[model samples]
Target: MAKFRKKPVVIEAVQYEFGMEDGFVVDGRYYDKSGPVPRAMNRIPAIKTLEGRHEISKGDWIITGIQGERYPCKPDIFAATYEAVE
Candidate 1:
């Protein structure tokens, strides 16, 4: 007989904007900060709260059960992030 295991789900962040690669643009005209800002994709997902349970969705930030760390990424990243688990 063969044994099977359930796979875990992974989440990531995604930006939602008009027409911009990675949904981020660099313009000198824009205001500048003292230090370089870590450009975050506009569509990138962070975290969300629902009913009473916790879950991860595409383009949604999440913490990996394997390492117990959280990060913001896109849906594609999420898919790749959990590819190993799945």
Candidate 2:
């Protein structure tokens, strides 16, 4: 067995919130914003990742990976995994 530690990397992220426009931009790319109907009929917040469309829940963090791919990460996990650079 071999052990390897994850290399530290700084990434760009934005917290998904209510009322953002459909064509809102993050990390220089535009993403469609949608979610529950209660938020004025916006589609479920999501991003097109390497795997597929991933839903972005309210309070979820949208993270841009090293290669510029974007995806959603739960707040709890994100808090435990990442920290503000400054």
Candidate 3:
């Protein structure tokens, strides 16, 4: 038998809305990608309940949360939108 470990990769994203007529929103905040942005919030936020509550929105920050989730914030919105919690 052989033991294998998983490798981790990093990605970048944003949290601004494409537009009211383009994507979806949660808690009155845009979470999906749409309109003329280079990349839309095409991926749905992933939620897990392993060690604790985990969530990763479409346009979340590159950093992960305590529960291994990502803070929801559009990349286009720049650093003014959301801040990853420590």
Q: Which prediction has the highest TM-score against the true structure? A: 2
Model 2, backbone clash pairs (residues 3+ apart or across chains), number: 6
lDDT of 2 by residue, 1-86 (tens): 99999999999998987653243344434456453233234445556779876666788888889999888889999999999998
Task: Report model 2's TM-score to 2 decimal places.
Answer: 0.68
Candidate lDDT values, in order? 0.37, 0.71, 0.41
* Over 4 Å off, model 3: 1-44, 47-51, 64-78, 81-86
Off by over 4 Å in 2: 19-43
TM-score of each: 0.24, 0.68, 0.21
Residue 69 in model 2: lDDT: 88
lDDT of 1 at 70: 42
- Whichever of 2 and 3 has more TM-score, that candidate is 2
Better candidate number, 1 or 3, judged by TM-score? 1
Please, what are the lDDT tens digits per residue for candidate 1 over residues 1-86? 99998675553323333321222223322212333434744323223223222323343434434444443445666566555423
**Pick by lDDT: 2 or 3, better one:** 2
Q: Rank order by TM-score, top first?
A: 2, 1, 3
